[model samples]
Target: MNQLDIDKMVLRLNVGYNGFKFKESDLKDGELKDWAKKNNLLKSDDKQKD
Candidate 1:
């Protein structure tokens, strides 16, 4: 998909999540896990797996 379409999907997802708003870079750079860890968004088991 195009960037605009990806942006729109990210926007929609962020709207549903209340506090977390993910940037395209987060997904693109594979930093989502780190971001989630910093934000305390990951579960204890998931964190351990990482």
Candidate 2:
């Protein structure tokens, strides 16, 4: 497996996170909805549509 390191500060301004941590398996398993929910990017009504 390969890993990438990102600066949390840079990401915060762009993706709205002061700090973030993730494993490659998250992507591999297609878990972005979980991520969005954690970041408050997904609304409950939006989830119901899916």
Q: Which candidate is the best by lDDT?
A: 1
Among all windows of 10 consecutive residues in model 1, the one with the lowest summed lDDT is: 41-50
For candidate 1, write residues 1-50 as lDDT tens digits. Answer: 88655655565566457745544334443354455446554344332442
Which sections of candidate 2 miss by over 4 Å? 1-30, 46-50
Tens-place lDDT digits, model 2, residues 1-50 = 22222332333344455334333233332344455546543335332442
Clashing pairs in 1: none
Itemize residue pairs with steric clashes in candidate 2. Answer: none
For each candidate, what is the lDDT? 0.49, 0.39
Error of 1 at 12 (Å): 0.3
Overall local distance difference test of candidate 1 = 0.49
